[model samples]
Each structure stands twice: as structure tokens, then as C-alpha cells.
Target: MMISYADSALSVLPPLLAITLAIFTRKVLLSLGVGILLGALLLTDFSMIGSGEYLANTVSQLVWKDAALNSWNVYILGFLIVLGMITALITVSGSARAFADWAKLHIRNKRDAKLMTMFLGCVVFIDDYFNSLVVGSISRPITDRYHISRAKLAYILDSTAAPVCVISPVSSWGAYIIALIGGILTAHGFADAGHLSVFVQMIPMNFYAVFSLLLLLCVAAFSLDVGPMRQHELNALRGNLFDETKGQPPGATTDLPEADTGKVIGLFLPIAILVFATVYFMVSSGADSLAASELPFSVLGAFENTDVSSSLFFGSLVGFIATVGLAIQQKVEWSMLVKGMVVGARSMLPAIYILLFAWTIASVIGQLETGKYMASLATDNIPFALLPAVLFVLAGVTAFSTGTSWGTFGIMLPIAADMAMGSDSSMMLPMLAAVLSGAVFGDHCSPISDTTILSSTGASCHHIDHVVTQLPYALITAFISIVGYTVLGFTGSLMAGLISCSVLFVISIVILHFWAKK
Candidate 1:
């Protein structure tokens, strides 16, 4: 059923209910389920049978889209499971422990641990999912050895993932946004504008992304742990990496068997292969897509057309095979190999459940036209000088409510372009950039976000703990971004906006330092 409640105010209720309940109750699955049920009921006009059918169809689409078994959601879920199994095999082969022991020699303090993790997060900017899980896999041992909290590690992963991806033109986010910008420009008669150049131009205007990364570095360099993050840091320093009361997080497999001897090569080789293979596949997939289209082949064009879900799955499968090969080469018991794969698959069940629920609810919200409703409210009767600022806030709220930045980008970008045309054509870039920045900001804070959930899973931290601790930092960056976008809107100077954000960020850092001392 293709239904839209875009004109109805009730369109906003389901997501609001879910987000509010998740934050307050800290019961993510229950909250999402309730929201999904309520949205389905609303869509079906409160008919129980209709609602059930709606939900079943939505869930079924996760694996079957267009009556095909191959779906992006299925590929992503498969990647997670394969990656989990690789992680387990690495553990069983003793590669992870050996790598950790090697890291301990060089990462001598908590600060180094933090910075290393941040650096890794930034370097792996091809995709947020890749960044979150792989960086967590690589950095967890070092951070844990230094008594860094999983919450803090997850915060680093979360911050670095989307912010970096949003700004980096080579990333999946970059490719997607560039493609959107291309269509929007064509629609507005800027068909001659180079999409890549346009994306690069807006990079600085993406104040939320630029500043969120700056804030992440500041958090690491100055130990600027505020809000819930402060307590999490303190607890970590006191030898508690996670809240035992919350139980083991997804991917925290304690009963997995380990070999008596292992090599660091076991860890590095698989990760390197995974990263390289994934990138290669991404480019190859993009090339394949370009070949089928009328567009000329270019590296940027390739990325803009790539199938990221399939690439991740292929890459993880290769990595899993490498891990298994290494385990066998190490004379790891066959029984241990079987146990590791089984345990690894089991470890991802919680995350899989959450992903399924989150994906389904997101579909329901789409049916309800929640983002469309929110976008409508902000695009009307807005002053030209406030367009960028207004769009930033609007995009943030839309993404936060929808729990999907890409969806927000799709909903808001054309709307932003249309609004900009009515005001000032030159303001288009700033407005579009604001939408991107705000979407990333909202995604960072949204509990139902896949990146947020994966960041928690990667660090094996309580999901709610990661969400709560990361919110303050995301909010601070968002506030600075609002100011920056406002300056850009009024002055039409991207530099002015950049300066405004830079000054505010420094001021915020100083305040954080003094407050932490107090």
C-alpha cells in the first residue's frame, strides 16, 4: 500500500513516540516496535488485520524487495553476520590478543589510545558502517588495555564515522549526496555544474560535519568529557569498561575458544584484505553501474553509482574466508573453528533484531510521510537571509525523527533547492550543505540509527550508554553549526560562516576545560 499522510499532523506522532520512549525508557526494541505498530495502525485506519498485514509486508521487504531475494537490507545483514564470524575466528586464532599485546607496547596511555582510535576512524572513511565496525575491531584492544570506556570508544567511532563520511567526497555518503546535488542542480537549470566540484565547494559549508570532527579531536586531546560522557570516562578509569548491570552488548562473546598461540598477522592481514577488497568492489560495482548507464565513466561517477551493501557483503565474505584460513594454518582445532562461527553468528542476533525493527519502523515512517510533513513546515514563508539556518534545523529535526540521514537528504535537498530559487539562486549551495550537515548531526544523536547501533556493537558497549554519552557532543556541534549556517545565510560568505564556527568551537572547548576542572 503506497499511502502518504504528508498533509496530516498525525504523521509526526509515530517517530516522536518512538524517539521519546527510547531515550526515556532506554528500551530500544520495545520502543521501536510500539512506534511501528502505532504507525501501521494509523496507516490502516486502526484495523488490526490491516496493520498486521502492513507490518508483515514491511518486514518481508527487508529480504525481498520487488519479489527478489537480493535486497540491500539482506546484504547488509549478511555482512554483519560474516564480519562477526571473522571477528570470532580472529579471536579463536589468538590474533586479536596478540595484536592487543603488541598495541600495549606502543599505545602507552589513554590519550594515545583515544587519538589512535580517532585517527583510525578518520582514515576508514569509505563508509560509516565500515568505519564504525572496523575501527572498533582494530582499536578496542588498545583502548580496553588503557582502561578507556567502551562508551567513549563508541562515541569516537560514532562521531568520526558520519562526520568524516559526510565531508569526504570519496565516501559512500559523499557519493550519494553528490548524486542528489547533481539531480537538484539539473532540476534548477544548473545542469552544467560539475557535481564533484559542487560537493567540494559545500564541504566547508557543512559546518556540522567539519565542526563535529573538530569537536571529536578536542574531546580526545583535552579530555573534554562532559555530560554523561564524564561519568563514563571516570568509570572507565576506575576499571569498568561497561556497566555490568546492562549486560554484555552485541558482539561481546566471552565463551569463545582461543588458541594457545597466535600471530598479529592474523589480525592485520584479514583487516587489510577486508578494507582493500571492499574498496575494490565498491569501485568495480560503480564501474558496472556506469557501464549500464549513459553517464561517462569516472572515479567519482563510479562511486556515485556503486552498490554499497553488496560491496560490504562481498568484502566481509573475503575477510571471513581469510580468517578461517589463518585459523586452520595455525592448527586451530576444527571444533574451535565450528564453535567460533556458531558463537559469532549468535553474537549478532541482538543487533540483527534491532536492525530489522529499525528498518521496518523507518519504512512505516516513510509510509506516514513523516519527513515530508516536517519538511513542509519549514520550507514555507521563510526569510531568504535565514534559509540556510532554517534548513539546517529542519534537516536535523527531520533526520532525527526519521532516524536516517539519507532519507532526510532525499526529502530536504530538492525542497531546499526550491526554497533557495524563490529567495536567492546563489544561496543554493549553502542551503544544501546545511541539509547535509544537519542530517549527519541528527543521525549522530538518533538512537534508532544504524550507525549508532553499529558503533555500540563495535565497542561492545551498552547501546543506550553510547547514545546518552554521545548526545551532548553532537548537540554542541549542532549549535555551532546553526550559528555558522546563519552567518552564511545572512552574509553569503562561506568564510564568515567558517570563522564563526571555529571561534565558537574554541570557546566551547575552553568552557569544557574549565567545567571539567570544576
Candidate 2:
């Protein structure tokens, strides 16, 4: 049986220390590393790390093995590397430049450039990791030509990645969420309402995801800026994407390896193949699962049965093959292709390291059972009408502290499902929506979060700048989400709550824009 630490208040300390240090120091990597170290010490019952014999042993066992050497941890790192290579291949082939030129005719102004970035972000919903890197690389040139701030560009990339995936039922995110919810249902001996169906029902109720995209649209279309983003935008208007007199940092130096012939096809076709393959593999996996289970045929049924991690890896691999094959067809030599892949992988090395630390700290926190400890606090006595909002805060804090949305999902989905099955059953869908929305919102802001780091890397912006500029926007949407969840929890009216939240999002943004640089 799995160990439980639901009553242990010490469980939350590791992640809390990480969050506090990250915000205080603005050094995410160091903060995470120290947090993991502190967690290890705590795990040893507050043993001193500087003491004689235990130091090397603690560093090797906890930091290296327990955190980094885990299998799934390696796969996630590998996924980022492969995705980086694909983006690099696209850039090295001149596909990104060609796309930018093609976009020039249709994109005549800053709004057009921003809109294109926003549109691409929404369209590339296969995986959040893919979306951030691919969209940033492809859209940055256009945004740069129009003097759009890298901060804004990063915002567009960051906002779209997680929000789009959660709502996109065809994404790896969807499959993972389905499996999580389904596993919970099965554990509780209540599996009739398929995870996919429940997920679909909760879609409209996902206030943060839905509104985050909308807020991105508003920011793009209206040039809305607030807080630190306002300063960034104003600097961009003066041709300073960064607020430094050092001028813009030079971008990657990779020569085009292919002729401009079929540039659009070379760029977009490969992306489409990747998306289609990912969806195909996911659906295929789901279908196979359904067949083995002898379940009734339904679209949602297939999704609930899907294997997300396997499908993500499979789809990305196929996409890599397709992209390389497309490059050869376009007369690109194998040497240049290999070079591009290397360059791309190298570029992603920093991000991969950050992920390594993030996964490690999150693993340490998991070992501490932080989520269960928090969930234990959410007992049946809490009013159902307040549960969704409360759970949203809890999930958000948990995700922010741990810096892993997937980990948050794994922890919260089962707890939310159980709570729904308990006395306060009316809040199931709302609570479900709350958990999903909160995870994305928190992950969006956390400096150590993989998606947050990827968004900055993808946009080629300074990582801290991305984190600094985007947090206010994420918090605004999250505030709207909390209010929306509260309404939903109370009345169980998805439409009313969503509408109120939507209106609040627009109005609050507009008001903030006025308060910002115009």
C-alpha cells in the first residue's frame, strides 16, 4: 500500500520554500536546487547537510537518484530535446523566414503580426511544449519586424500553450486529463460517466483556460498592456524589445539550408503532420483501450481509454520523421539537417536543465505527499458552494509551489473526484474545472514551471522578463476564474458564471489598459 502523509504539515514546507525563494531571489534554478536540498534534509528529519558522513550520501541519493535519474523524468527531458530539434530544423531550413515573408503580405501592421502569433498559438494545440517553441520561433520574426515586445510575444506564447491544450480534446493534455479522471472514477467503483464526457462537460466551465485565450486575443488586438508589460511595450515602440541601451540581443546564427521553394509547405506541412500524427496516435491508443475493455462506442469513450504519454512520444517521433523527410524532399542535404538538429538541441539545453531541476523538486515534494496533505485539509465539512473556489486556490498554490501542472493534476483530480463522490456531490464538474484551470494558471506564473521556461525560450526573451511580465496577466485571469468558480459552485450555472467572468475579463483588461501605457 502507498504511504499517506495527509496529516503531516511538514509536507508543504519543501515546495513552499521553493516558491518563497524563487519569488525572493529571481533565481529559479538555484531556488529549486536549494529547495530540493532542504527537502532532502527534512526527509532525513532535519538532518544537517554540512555534517560529516551524510553529506555526500544525501547529495547522491536524494538530489541525483531520487530527482534526476527517474525514468519518466528522463522521458520528459528527451521530449523537450526532440521538440527543440524539430523547431531548429524548421529554422535552419529557412522555413521560418519564408513563413515570415509569406505572412508579410497578409500581415501589414503590428496588430496583424500579433494576431498571427495569437492564431498560431491557438492552432498549435497538440502539446504545450510544442506550441510554445514552434509558435515563438515562427512568429518572432514577424513580431520583431513590427517592434512587438519580446515580452508580449512571450506572453502570447505562454498564454496559448497551456490554455489551448486543456480545451483541445485532441491534445496530449486532454488524453492525460482523461486518464487521470478515469483512473479516479475506477478507483471509487464509479466508472459509468466516461472521463472524456466529463471532461467535455467541464470544458465550458474551464474559466481560466477559456478566458486566458480571450485575454491574449484582447491583448493582441488592442495592444493592451499593464504593469511591467506596459514598460516593455513602450520600450518596444522605441525599437527596444528589451529595455536596455544594449540594443536587441542577436538571435541564433543558422544559415538557411533549403531554397525558398514551397516554403509554406515545408514549414506548415510538417507541423500539420505532427499534429495529425499525435491526434491519430492518441485516438488509436484510446480505441485500442476501448476495444480491450469491451466498452460501448463513443468519441469520449475512446479518449478516456487513451494512453497519453505513449501517444505524445509516438506522435513527436513521427513528426520528427516527417519533418526530416520533408527536408530531404526539399533538397536539403543530410549534413545541414543534422547540423540544424544539433543547433536546436543545444539551444534547448538550458531549458532541459531547468526541467531537470523542476522535475526533481516536484518529485521531492511528491515524496513528501504535499498534495495529499493539502487535500486532507479539504474535508467534507467545507461548504459545496465554496469548494470550487477553495479548491482552485489550493490547486493553484500547489501547482505554483511544485512548478508542475501534471503533478498537480495527478494529485488533485483524484481528490476532487472523491470529494464529489462524497456528500458535496453537486460541485463535481465545477470542481473538476477548477482543478484544471488552477493548475494551468499556477503553472503559467511559476518561474520554475516548464511551460513558463519554454515560453521564454521559445520567444527568445530573457526568462525572468517573461516571468515578470506575464504574472500580472495570469493573476488577473485567475482572479476572474476564482469569481467564476465561486458562482458556479453556488448556482451550478455554467453559462451565467462564464458570461460574468468573460465580461469581467474584458472590462478588467480594458481598465488595466487605460491604467497602462496607451
Candidate 3:
């Protein structure tokens, strides 16, 4: 039974309630549950406001039936588990430590250490969770050796995590976005719409993510700093890596079976397997979609048409097997490997829990027709020229409030598509890019965001400290993105807009480099 609710301004209440409770209470899981419960109550027309019986029925039918039972959702769940296992096996086999030791031999200064951290985070692009966890685990020891502030390390980790994932078409974020946009466009009767082709085009227009990366490059290259981050870096220069007033986050010590430190292939092989396997599976699975679509198949086209679930599952599975196989070859016993897998899986509980609740909330939002309601409201009076910017702001707010970029994608993509259906392709593309950019922006800043949590957890930094140090940079990039979208709306030229935005981003970064106070 579909749990239907009135499609009006009131439909926004569920997500609003969830977002409110999350921000104030900082109890994300409980807050999201309450939000879903609130939506259920409203769906029942408030007749079941205080009735657990009604809420139970709602959860059983709406959340469980509609959201969790989906095969792709299950695939994501499995991928998360396998990824955790891979991380653990690497750690317990001493490959990660050996890799870290190898890095230490090459990095001579704090600047190089920070750059390398960011570079590794970008390179490991399979998933944001893995990026944060692995980069933080391996790089923290090296960063600490140079007295790099935990806050700075957290910022680098967080910056590279979501931004890189959002832009990389092969990342988990890519699969989610492709499915989302494709579904929306197909529903709206976009006859010639090729989701992958459009997705490939929007990469340049995803200004927040694109510029956030460029800004990171500038910051890393020039050693730029501003506001609180500058203070943190300066304090580190004085051999103070953390604030004395703040309680220090306890660092984790890994227990690993010894292996040869020279065997760096043990580390590189797993990651390489994950990337290569995913691409190979994607290409293989997409052969039919490619054959069916307008021919001349490209990598993005093949991937967008492919089975995301099977590819990701197979990729992560093979990566885990390769990792375990290497661990066994290193003379590590099965008992130790199994224990490490269990430990790694346990570490991901918080993020996994958050995704479950987020999926539930997204299901509730869909039931309420919140996205359609939003589309109707915005289209009624909002001018077409300003629509992209408005959608960008709306998406940013939703993601910031909900603390989930994927959730934001679920809620806002449909609305953006509805608004774009009748618009020209050139005009429509920026709107899509805006939705993506905003989702990433909001997720980066939200304290309850999984990426943010993982980033701090990975860096062994205080969570709030990471949020504080990262927000200014996120906001700056968001502002630039919003302005760029507005320009794209006016000019309607993808190339011109991207070039201008690129110039603006570099100028802003240069200004921060010399003028912004350290």
C-alpha cells in the first residue's frame, strides 16, 4: 500500500523536521527516525499521531517495502561491507603501514605531506567513505610526524572525499546520480535524453565540486589559509598541532601481522583492482545499453547504461578477495584476517546506520510528492533565468539540513528535472549541475554528514573542529558556484561559463593567498 500524503507546502515538513532535529540534537539516527515517523503521521492525516500501531504499519509498507527491498539498495549495502573488509585486511596485513612508511621516506615537509594526503584522497575515488577511512588511517601518522594539525588533515580528507567522488563518473556518486537523472528525465518524457551523455557534459558545469578541487590545488600549492584554518596552521608552525582547550581525540593503534615493508604492491594492487574491475564490469554490463542507445559508445555512455549494482558489488568483492589473498600470502592467518574484517565492518556502523535512515526519509519524501510540490511552487512564479540558481540554493539547504548528499540527490533531482523538462538543453544542463553542486556543498558542511564524520574519524580530529575549519572553504566554493550558475543562466554557453568560472576561482584563490589574513 502506497502511503500517500497531501502535496502542498506542508509536504516539506518531514524533511524539515528531520533536519531540525539533526542540527540541534546532533543525534542523527534518532532524529531521522523521528522525521520518518512524523511523515508517517502526516500521511495518516494525523489520525495516527500518537499511534505506534499506525507508524509500524507505515514503516512496514512504505519504508521497508519501497526503499530497503530494492536490489540496488542491497547492492550498496553489500559494497559498503566489502569495502570495510578491504580496508581492514590492508591494515592488518601491515600494507597500509608499510605504504605510510614508504611515504615518510619521500615527504620532506608539512606542505608536501598535506599535498600528498589530498592527492591520495583524490586518487582513491571508488567511494567517499573508503577515501576518508583509508587516507586518514594511513596518512595521519605521516601528517602527525610533520606536526600537521588534525583540523587541517580533516579538511584535506573531507575536501578530497566528496568533491572527487561527485566529479568522477566511475565513483559510487556517479552511479547514483546517473540513475537519478535518468529516472527523472524518462518520467518527464525527455525523448532524446541520454543521461550518461548529459552527465558527462555537466561535469564541467558542476562548479562547486570542480572549483572546490581547484581551490584545494591552490591552497595546497600556495599554502593559502584564511579565518580559522589559518590560525590552526600557524599554531602548528609553533609545534602546536591541536588546541589545548579542545579535548584530544584518542588515536587508534592497529594490530597487524608483520609483513615486508618493501611489498608496496600489497597496498597498490587492491586499489588498482577495485578501479579496473569496476570499469571492466561496467563496460561489460553496459554492452546492451550501448547497443540499444544511439551508437558510437563512449566510456561514460557505456557506464551510465550499465548495471551499477553488479559492477560495484563485483568490483568491491574482487578487491576484498585480492586483499585477503595477499594477507594470506603474507603469512597472516585466516583468524587474524577475519578479525580485521569484522573490526573494519564494525567501524562503518555509524555510516551504514545513517544511510538506512536516510533512505527511509527519502522514501517518505517521495511518498509525499515533496519534489513535485517543490517543482510546482518554484515554477509558478520563479523566472526561468533564475531557476538554476534557485535550485542550487534549494539543494544546498536540503543537503545541509539533512546531512546526506545522496539523500539530497533523491529529493532534489526529480524537482530539478521537472523544472527542466520544457527548457532548452543548454538551459537545462546548468540546472542539473546546480543540483549536484549544491548537494555536495551542503554535505561538506553538515556536521552530521557521513563524509564529515568519517573525515574526522579518519584524521583522529575532533568532529566539530573539522566542521568549523571546513565550513568557510565550503561556503566560499558554494558562493562561487552559485554565481557561476547565474552566469550560465544568462549566457547559456557551457564553455564560456566554465572558463569564466575557472578564472574567477583562480582569482579568488589568489586573493586569499596574498590578501586573506593567515
Candidate 4:
């Protein structure tokens, strides 16, 4: 039912109540269920209050009529099903066991186990969502075999996922940035100009992305652990970090399984297809140019008309289905395959709910024009040079609170870009980069973020457990980014800012290493 204000309040009350309940209960699913029920109740209450017909309409509107139903939800669900099928096939064919066995032979040490994960994360930089799922699933067994903590695994997965994509040029994220920048430039009266090219060329100067990559590299290279991460590593080193639920079959003494070459090939096949298809669709969609080709229309004409997310959703679905079919052909049983698919899809339930809740919150906030309201509240007393940073932080806060990075970007990017119109062309790239970085920064740390939930689920750790463990690391990176952006604001040299941030980041890591040991 379309809930009245009082009924809506009653409906929403349980989720808030659940949050408190979870603190005492530590029951993740129960907490999530409470939240979900609250959402349904809110809809139901509305319907009960002289809006019976509207209730069904509201439910349909919220769950089905929304853009999420047509796009993000379907894409996520499709990927989950695919992942499940792949997992079932691997388990049935004993490929997971085989891979674990191979890892035992080569990755004898804990540090190597962690490094391998970080490296794999870098290689799968095409999509943050894909990277989180693929890297975490593939590496989980190996890491567990080495007694690595799920908390640590979650940290590695989270760190590498978005950071890698924000800097990569071939991913869907890259396309979005290009399109946004193009729009921003044209809106600023720079239409038909090469402003976007200038922005792209200045990416290496994006201190936040560059420094983030360096931070990840340093963590991998030095094995520098701090806060909860350090504790987790120490526990692993003491041979007490593996989940009791994981490891070899009950009778098997060795934790690691023997390598199966066929399993590895099978695993890579779907991944390769997904990557290739993503790139192809991205290019064909006219999001960006990989090479020069002459046509009757403009070179960028394809992207001009193509909807990037639509292409991504379709391409990913196709790759997912193809991979599932291949797994079935490999003798994965239907029942077990279905079970795996169910589990995989189940893993995403928290994310789906969070997305839906976030969407509603954002939709409500938009109706009130919250971002615009906030923007208007910023007085003329604020320095013009600091406007970009202020907007960046504002966007970050919104995303953090709402736990929806795209929604945050949708509101703040246009505003920030508009504010930067009168600024130097060279400054626009860094500013935009700052906004993107801040959005990610907030999403990474927000307990409500979908990626955070997925990371926790993938690692089989408590969602809050992952959030608490990774907070310190995310904060350190964010601090570095803030400083980096500050430098960029004054100097307008992206390269200088990046270099400075990288050097400082290394020093901070060194400090953390000593502190962690102490």
C-alpha cells in the first residue's frame, strides 16, 4: 500500500531497529531481512491507507518500473547466475581443487598468496563489479589454503577493484568518464573543441588514481599490514586464519588440491570472452576511439548514439550465458549447477536490496532537490579555487551516506563540471578526477555500499567485519587523495601532484609497517 507519512515512518522504523539489533545480535541476514521487510511494509502501509490499488502499482513501480529493473538489477542477477554456474562446474569437475593444489606447490608463503591476489585484481580491471566477484572467487580457495583471513581477502579485493578501473582506459568506467567530460566541455561552450582529448591526456596527472595504484602496489610489494589487516596477517602467519568451513574434503590432510590444467583453461575462457566483448561493445558503442576509422559519419558518432550501460548489460549477459553453457558441457550436474547458481544469486541479495533502498532514498532526495539545495547554501565567502574540492567532498558525503556511487555522480558531477566551466581547461580534468575519486572513496568505506557487501559475501566474512577491517586502509588512501587534490588545486600540474602523492604514500606505508609491528 502507498504508505501515509505515519505509516511510512512505522515501516521505516524496523530497519533502524534492525541496525541496533545487529549490534547486539551480530546476525547479518536477520538484520538484512528486517531492512527488507521494512521496505515492503512501507509500500504495504501506503496501500492500506486508501491506496489499495496504488499499492500494487507502487510495488511494480519500485521493483519493476525503475531503471534498475531494466538495467543494473538484471546485469547483476545475470552475472550472479553465471558465477554460480561457473562455481558449480569448477567444483563438479574438481577444477577448484586442482587450482588449489597448483597454488600450494607454487605459492608456499602467505605473502605470495596475497600478492597473487593483488596481481590478479590488477589484470581484471575492466569492471569493478566483475573484478570483485571474479578475483575473490578464484583466489578464495588458494588464500584459505594458505590460512589467509577472509578479512584480508576482502581488503585485497576491495582495494584492487575500483582503483584499477578508475585508472584503466578500456573499461566501461573509462567510457563514462569520456562521455561526461565531453558533455561538460560542450556545456561550458567548448563544443567542437578538443577539450576531452586534453582531459584524457591529463589522466596520468590524476593524483588520486595514480596514488591509489601506487598505494596498492606498495601494499602488495612490501606486505605492509596495519590495523585489522596487520592482525589478520599475523593470525595467518601463525596458521590460524583459515575459515573452519573451508579447505579440502573432510578426509583430506592437505589443504591444497592438485592442479588441473583443463580447469584453469575453462575458468579463463569465460573471463576472456567477457573482457573481449566488453571492449568490443565499448568501442562499437562509440564511447571512445581505439583506432582511427573513416566513415560517412563522425569518428565519435557511434558513442554519440550508443547507450554504454545497455551495451555493457547485453555483452555481459551474453558472456555469462555462454560460460554457463560451457560449464554444463564440462559435466557439471544440473542440480548442483542450479544450487551454485542459487547460492551465487543469493550472495547478491544484500547488494540488490541496498541498491533498491539507495535508489528510493536518492529518488526522494532528488524530489526535494537536496543537492541543489546544498549547492545553493554554499555562500560566496567560499573561495572559487576551493569549489572543486568542496564539491568533491560533498559528492563523497552524499554517496557515502546513500551508498550509491552512480546516483551520487549523477547529481554532483554535472554541478561540479558546471562550476568548473570558467576555470582553466587543464584544471577540469583533475577536478573531475577528484570528484570521481571522492565518490569511490565514500563508496569504499560506506558500510552500506554494494561493493562492500559483495566483498564481504565473496570472502565469507561478516559484512561489518570487512567494513571495520578495511576502514583504516580506505581512510589512509582518502587522506592521501585529499592532499593530492589540494596540491593540484594550487599548482595545476597533475604530474607533480601525482608524484608528490606517490612519494608521500610510500612514506605513510613505511610508518604503518613499523606501527603495525609494534
Identify the leading candidate in terms of lDDT: 1
Candidate 3 local lDDT, 141-203, one digit each (tens): 678778788889999988999989888877668867887877777776775787778788889
lDDT of each: 0.89, 0.77, 0.74, 0.62
Model 1 over residues 233-285: C-alpha lDDT tens digits?
A: 89988998899887778878778878978899999999999999999999999
Greater lDDT among 1 and 4 belongs to 1
**What TM-scores do the predictions have?**
0.98, 0.85, 0.77, 0.78
In model 4, the clashing pairs are 1-43, 1-44, 1-46, 1-47, 2-46, 2-47, 3-46, 101-257, 286-303
lDDT of 2 at 126: 70
Stretches of candidate 2 exceeding 4 Å from the true structure: 1-6, 48-71, 183-191, 242-262, 283-318, 321-338, 379-381, 421-424
Clashing pairs in 3: none
Clashes of each: 0, 0, 0, 9
* Candidate 4: segments with Cα more than 4 A from true spot: 1-59, 66-69, 235-262, 277-378, 422-426
lDDT of 4: 0.62
Q: Which predicted model would earn the best TM-score?
A: 1
State in Å the error of residue 369, model 3: 3.6
Question: CA lDDT of 361 in candidate 1?
Answer: 89
**In candidate 1, what residue range of length 10 has the lowest lDDT sum?**
378-387
